[model samples]
Target: MQNFLKKLRFDDVPILDKASLYELLNQRFADEEKKLSQIPNPSLLHDAPKAAKKIADAIREGKKITLVGDYDVDGISSTAIMIDFFRQIPYPLEAIIPNRFSDGYGVSPNLLKRVNADLIITVDNGITAIEAAQVCKERGIELIITDHHTPLDTLPEAYAIVNPKLSTCSYPFQEICGAQVAWLLLGLLKKELNLNIDMREFLDILCIAIIADIMPLVDINRTLVKEGLKVLMSSQRPSSLIIKDFLNKSSITSEDIAFQIAPRINSAGRLEDASISLEFLTAASTNQAYKQFEKLNSLNERRREWEAETTNEAIKLVNSDDTIIVVAKEDWHEGVVGIVAARLVEHFSKPAIVLSINNGIAKGSARSIGNVNIYELIKQNGHLLTKFGGHKMAAGLGLDEQDIDAFRIAINESASKLNSDDFKSLDEVIGILPSSEIDIELLNLLESFEPYGEANSRPLFLIKDAQILETKTFGKESSHSKVTLRQFAHEKKSIELIQFKRVLDIPSEKKLTCSYRVVKNEFNSRVSAQLIINKTYNY
Candidate 1:
């Protein structure tokens, strides 16, 4: 890996130095390993206890309840939690997931006309539905909103609103996602009723939502994921029969969620209907769950095909000289634009926006790399946008056909003035590892860094003078690559390491420097040392 590290250079990254990288990973993993009895619960900001109580009373009385959920994993997982919790109370409950392209976002008048229930519960959304809640109020429908997104200036008039982002809320950590909020709601219910339901029973579902929402894996989130993965591995949770079937055959990890489960759940929204995933999660019987699970698996296969096509097109758009890329194509599926935006951001190593253009409007998704804030960028140009809102790293926008060119030009101008050095390249020196430290003990110490996602990335160690011993591509389409690397780090001690999915463009021969993590690969009743490559260089 000596040759590979030679090519690494970052001209201007003021905050992140080699020392900082080491400290970040060491401190992060060390802190995560110390498990807490429970995460410090954020107090309810708004005085909505009465509303939650009322819903609990309704649930206790066996009244009909319906939940409105978003069409993504966060929404689905939240729905699953509430649905499973309500089942214990033996309450009549149902859920609805709006079509992403048609219903837009949040509770709408169109949706109110569809479901006939005594009370309505919204998950992962509905923090800013003034008019829709008004309609529900007029129709005598009580609403309980469990969301974590920022609220509007005037809160909606609902039966009860539970959101961590509320200004008046006293929640210690205001950064939780909607599924976590739903999990909290369940916790509240258990406390009030003094139910003996196993607290860890639902962690597996929460883990899926936690990873899917891209929330920071710190604070209370870390505990949830830490314990959640344990419960999932034990196969003790109320999960879909198909999920259990898969887990029984193979060991599950964070990698399983990213590569296996989350994609299948997300595939529903990208390709067909997201309701398929919700049905699978909340299915009444193993037979029903199997059918739904199979359907989601098939849908995920289609999603892969669609994403491959769209990514190719997005890569072509990157050849342009603009600081920000805005690409629109009529054939692209709107639901998958966010995924395409993410893919483009990785490929170009810059902020990117992907739009599905049809008729006279463009609906798009934007993703940022490094320190670029797409939300702030869009807010500066909000006047030109028909609708736009999101967090720092990701955003969504709606643009009128007439103003697309102007918006693009304005964003490009803003991007040009920003310092490009911060993101000129992704050549980061993660860690420098002594060759002697590449052993089972080191790999075991790394286990403290569980439930890695977003900001809580896996630790990457830099090692020098590694030679590629073998290279092969696996998987049906040859989309995955596996390699064996050999390096002599100490006095006459040779280390053989395995790396997975290193890009083909990466040269195979010569001394290379690699940013990697040491992990244990257990196979054939033996545990062997392996290196998971994050980035490599011919330094």
Candidate 2:
């Protein structure tokens, strides 16, 4: 997302010196060890022990156990975690992620038609499977649901429902993603069966899911991601090996996983069957992993193309005066609607819902900007929606094609109740800094806050009075630019910053204030300090 940043000044917090900066940071990051250890026991989740016992009975009885997973990275990772754990027991289990084109999201009646099993488990989804759970009950298939999404007032009547957001849930941390819930339940199952499985072994993939699902990077999530990055750094997983080879980097960071890896895994589900990603992640051979990665990469490229086209069309539908943006096209690729909604949110600074109409139902995704809760906004207009589910910042829903106009107008009317500030951009910059401070040390200070996402984000610094020494568009189609600039702080230090997307129109005077992020760039065994230009304000 291109950022037009608002300055965040800590006037009383001193950071010009190391001691004070460390003090402030220490205060921000209180009790690292205590917080890291706060990942409570798995049994704390409601229905965990019962779910584990039932699963253990199924495993012992040699019953057919099928895991119904969603299509996103979280769902795939949750399924992959199950695959990894079950393979250790030498217990064969069936795993399937819903097909975006055919089955749509989560456990649906359409998807259950393809499942034939004695035991069925849902990961990352099924919280809203009121009808599907009923179908399973009628079929006498034991259902176990493990999810992290916010549940409805009426829960699924399954054998077990484990969700952190459940009103009766006992889990301490509610922000964990679906894979974490899946991993936790499996952890309890391992205990029930007295298996010697090392749960940390799954962190490498678990971290990917946590980041991909947009879980807040704090407390339990922080520790897991930190450890997961460590395992990923030295792990022998074929997917990890292939990613390292593809990126030409010996180490991977959360940013790398979020930007480079998550999208690839998500691309499979977005445009095709997520099973491709599942197979790729659980591939037995590096060569096999390479093939799957190729497919994912290609699909990701195609997703980008479609997303650009869809976003362009969606942009035409936006009305600047609308408190909330609602846009839909008859055949907009449903896979890219969420991204288009997110783009509209970022660009227009309004909550957006982008839908793809086909048959007679319009289904798609919603993204919010600032403080507007997209889920609540949509829920307020639930009379027009056939179905809707999500949290504060994101959601997915569907309604009748005829209700699209009503939804648009109704949702905007609902949004009008929100404070005016709710529609503004959430981007933030931590005050100003001299470009001369763009050294390895300052980069390290930022790096101290590893695994930035959700609650914790990489800090942006405003560099004022920078002289653009040279600028030229790079990359295919001139999609990016490499700008060399010297700050007024020191002419001796000129830095290269990359700006993505449409090339910026450099000021005729070649002077501007750049909102940038300092990064440690390593390439071909060389390490250097660089910056990423997000936005530039002209004088």
Candidate 1: tens digits of C-alpha lDDT, residues 379-453 = 788789876656677777888878877888898887877886655434355555555656766655556566677
Candidate 2 residue pairs in backbone clash: none
lDDT by candidate, in order shown = 0.73, 0.85
Which has the greatest TM-score?
2
* Backbone N/Cα/C clashes per model: 20, 0
Report the C-alpha displacement of residue 416, candidate 2, in angstroms: 2.1
Among all windows of ten consecutive residues in candidate 2, which has the lowest summed lDDT?
1-10
Those runs of model 2 whose alpha carbons end farther than 4 Å from true positions after fitting are 1-27, 31-37, 489-492
Scored by lDDT, the top model is 2
User: Over the full model, what C-alpha lDDT does candidate 1 score relative to the true structure?
Assistant: 0.73
